[model samples]
Target chain A: MAVEPVKIKRGFQETESLKMLKESAVNVNLCYQCRKCSSGCPVADLTARDSVSDRTSAGPLDEKTGAGPDSVPEALRSGMARDSVPNSVPEALRSGMDLTPIQIIRAVRLGLEDLALNSKTIWLCTGCETCATRCPQDIDIAKVNSILRIMAYKRGIKPKLPNVAAFDRQFMANMKFFGRVYEMGLVNQLKLATRNFMQDMDLAGPMIFKGKIGFFPNFSGFLTMKKFLSRFKKARAGKN
Target chain B: MPEAIAYYPGCSLHSTAKEYDESLRAVFTKLGVELKEPEGWICCGASSAHSVDELLAAALPAQNLQLIEDMGAKEVAIPCAACFLRFKTSVYDMKQSKHLEGKVAETIGKKYGDTVTIRHPVEILEKMFANGAKNQIKKDLGKIKLACYYGCMLTRPPKVTQFDDCEDPQTMDRLLKQLGAETLVWSYKTDCCGASLALSEPDVVVKLSRDILADARACGAEAIVTACQLCQANLDTRQGQIAKKFNENFNLPILYFSQLVGLALGLEPGKLGFDKHLVDPKPLLRKYGLLL
Candidate 1:
């Protein structure tokens, strides 16, 4: 199969959001498509491209020579030890977000800020740091996703995964109001806002019985909390 | 006795994970380490704040660190993995970015010089009992099989949390071993439990946590021992729902490492807050003859 020549678009400038992500210390430009970050990602099961066939068929010798092998090496033909390679991208990835960590980084590097910011992968990311930890380039992909989320929120970009975004907003609001997470407040607000009332209702009775649910917010730290929040707002305002 | 270390339980200890707080205190006291919680400590801003506002996330935890400095404590111990990550990230940010330090100081209405060292209870217990806590062990848990789950925050993004190897951390495993519990080597030790999404996206939590539980079960672990309150809550509370959703029977009892440590230290099960867990660990404890 002959590969087609890809045309490179010229005179493209980096988006402000992309520059902001770079300034936040996420070296998106350093990702060399090694896909190590994607390979080892925990959620790669839900996010990475299904490149398993490509991986299994393209043996080490074929990959090194970039040619079809007539007589493949015995070691290479059998495919290197499976244990040495991370699990192949699972079938689950085909259903959810198509963009992997490397793909997200690639989008940012290519100045596709809108595509990166609006990606379902950004919202689904649990911030587990698996991508960041496994990134051979040491780029903090998790931090980049976080920054992209903030930018997406600031720009009023509607998240494809609204529940995830709603949860983040409700959680932050709870923190801002109580200077800590008020579980009841957060839950009630989230349920009302997202209309996800019956999702975890079964566990609530047991949780209450176990004394895990507090009836009211702890107002003891109100004063120091006020100071802390005010300063945080001032800093954010200054940044804006 | 060693000098008292400042303890910041974060919001979860005061609310949902009260058992974790009690068990941690009981275990530490038995180990002869005094814990002093600073007055009026707030939340660590958790996953929510960081996702929305980075500055708030830094400031919320910095305020607590400031309180530790105010108490003149040389070190502060955080039991919750998420809180530990927040504090560590705050200290890391303050050291790396003077701009962040100034903003944090401005927000907290106080200047913290980053003198107080942040320590996770696991790290402290690992160091304190490095020579084996056998002497402190009253009820041997040698018969109990446990899978130590580190979840996400305890050790992730090695630069932010520079405690152990990010991929396969062994701090919790080593701690469980000290308690004489048979710790199982599992693949999902550091996997995420869907965290805050536990509320917003229960299905996601169910899917992800179900995998962790199934993996532990596959390794022949009788119970899943977790260091994070969120991990414990998610894994314990969602098992039933997961069982129904996936048509699989998963009755795995998720426990805090502190609860197991308290048991080894001869603390009463009630005192350790065993009753608070959704998936009662008492049955598992009794099965292993660690409980009467």
Candidate 2:
């Protein structure tokens, strides 16, 4: 039993997500589905396969009429069947979000705000800039993804990948408290929050022995940083 | 033209990547360059900050730059690639957006004129090698093949970093070649090491780093030299896990470029802090007669 892929209406009001992407200087309209971004993406192999299988398993579509495979438009079914290897498409295109970099751009173009914001793609992005570096239209997909992450956070959307969000929150909190990232403190906080305490415990003893884990947080410029960060809060409030 | 530049040893250097900081200081000192640490510098608001709050990321590094500018230093050297990128991004963003610049200045309590230049230690070392520091190479690192891993930050989004060719950077390679080590030409030179995700998604980091290590080994590299703190830590610390997961040998020593430079300049191994690395590089160093 497979569900039909949600069909977005052809024209809709410009989405807030789309406006944010445009304001962030990402040229979402420039993407022509060249798939250059997916081809060079390092995480594409791992993420794309999962997304693609999910899409295909949800009822095969007739190529011509865009319906089910049983009542196929005949000509297009053969073509799709020929390319049904699933892994043949670029990894980014096969993503479970139904939105690789190009598809995300397209979704934004089509005003699919919730769909774009809720996708696992935003969390998985490493901000490596490989996609941006290779984008033929010179789209800064990496920056676009960053802005998306910020938007996702502001909207209070729980990330599909919880650990990454946990790490991001823990990291920022560490900086907010100590004025710098105290690794030992950060790890403890992260372990507690995520409760995966023993995940990297094997490397801990060796790291501690090597004197890499400082016992106390280095509070250099604590006062100045605290004062400075207040202004940031004010500015962010003004923006919101 | 200033003889000494301010040095910002970001949190990693103070903790996990101490060897990178120590070796950078030693190599610079040997080259007659002095590194000055600003009295009160904060974090650069690494990968985490930018994703959550844009202002915090820019303002955090802007504060450090303000401190450096206050000290009257025309330049600052950052050993960590992440810190270098943050500093560079802050300067670039401030220059582009006057509104953002004003907001950051208000936050930091100082208006940075974008005067202080942010430099990676690799850039400084490249400059030193160009300025006759090649003559100071005390020991010829004989027949030791090395893979100079630039990782992602030092050179990417070309306009921001402006360090080298974003795709196929050879700055570290050229520096190692001058140090008398055979730098291998490999495709994974600028690949992402799944930084920060080492904790959140260790599987991704392991898979990505495994490919990098396998490529280095296939390219005949005995050890991988890196300029970024995260790259060094991720590649070195995760090797045992990567090997166990993949059921393959990936015991390549991931050394900082500064450590190799320190070795070439005849600095003490103790001073270089090679003992701190999880994958002890001493065995590889001893094999190359770089250690006694």
Candidate 3:
């Protein structure tokens, strides 16, 4: 039996959020659930419960994938060779993060805003552009994830991954103040924001020993950065 | 023969990836390409600004692009892949949408004509080597096999970068082959290195980097070469963690392609910052007789 496509809500195009996404040029409707993006995405199935062998060897290939290569979905069969697709997602890495790249796009198209916004997939995205590059529809899924991240922030919906959210916030603050990234300050700020002082503390010894981490911040372009960032503040205030 | 091209090392070159800065300068100088850095170049708002405020991300790189224009250069070479992607995306976005360009100009207080072209060091080197620069190689790299890992940002999202083939980039491989190093055919060339999550969620990086390193080892590579600083750092600094977490022995030295180019050009290993690596590459270089 053929699975039916999910119906999009009426007046989706008239919504402000959809209009913003449309302006960004990401046409979610063009996606036909090809699964190419999920296949190539590094973080898509990191938290998958199935072991690599269980997923690659037994279940997906047999039960889900049907009999043989001919039984496979046409979209996947056309994109990747059968042998090359195995073991793409490794064994259990961490917990949570269920949605894949293809799933996230589907959620957005179906007007499931909260599901897409609060997904751990959006936070865990490395902005690697793998999904964007391989999409048959040419939808910039990575760009959509970035936009969703910003939207999540605007809505004050807590990020699924707090540490990743903290890191982005601190990184922006670092750029705003120093004009350039101050690794030392940024790390300290991230540590403070996340309150996970012990994490990655071991690497500090080697990093300092090799002079990889600069101890001080550079403020050479501080005034210029402050002046430049002020314009955004003014614009935001004007809009509000 | 060409006039000086603008060099934007980004923030990492000045700090965590200082060796990349040193070796890139050394190799480019050897290739007779003059690099002029724009004055007071700010951050391109790398993964952060874009993830938070789209306008801020576009504005940050616009300011730096304006500085490059002021330097009388039409092209800029960005070594860090993260910074390169941000700059290129900003330019691509502005060129595609005039509304974005107007908003960015308003935010930055300056209008950028989107005139500057962004090129990765690999692209620049590939062009140079093809154009009679191969004669500059002072020493052959012998038969040491390496995996040329492009990580994610280098040639991806072809619409923005418009560089080599995104699926299987061979520019770095072909460039290294010119100096006599064996480049392995690996499937993880454009795979993600978990760079954005390195600081936030290292367990993910460990798992991701482990697979990348394991694939390289499985393919009979003695070392890994790359053009991204974050990939180099994640692979180099996390090998022990990856080993401890996964019980796998992958001690491969992740090297910048520029460092190898400097070595092949007869520059001293110490001068190329080989000594600064967490996983020392000296023994591998010595075994291949590329270093004394």
TM-score of chain B of each: 0.96, 0.97, 0.97
| Model 2 misplaced regions, further than 4 Å | A1-4, A9-12, A47-98
TM values, all candidates: 0.88, 0.88, 0.89
Residue A237, candidate 1: Cα error in Å is 3.2
In candidate 3, what are the lDDT values of residues B77-126, reduced to their tens digit?
A: 99999999889889889888788888888877778976788999898898
Task: Identify the leading candidate in terms of lDDT.
Answer: 3
Model 3 CAPRI quality: acceptable
lDDT of 2: 0.79
| lDDT tens digits, residue span A97-175, model 3 | 5678888887887787777887788998888889999998899998989999989998999998899999999998898
Q: For residues A130-211, could you state the per-residue lDDT of candidate 1 as single tens digits?
A: 7888877888888888888988898999997898898888887777678767788888998899987787899889999888
Q: What is the lDDT of residue B127 in candidate 2?
A: 81
Evaluated with TM-score, which candidate comes out highest? 3
Tens digit per residue, CA lDDT, model 1, B186-224: 877888888876876566677678767767887789999
Pitting candidate 1 against candidate 3, the one with the higher DockQ is 3
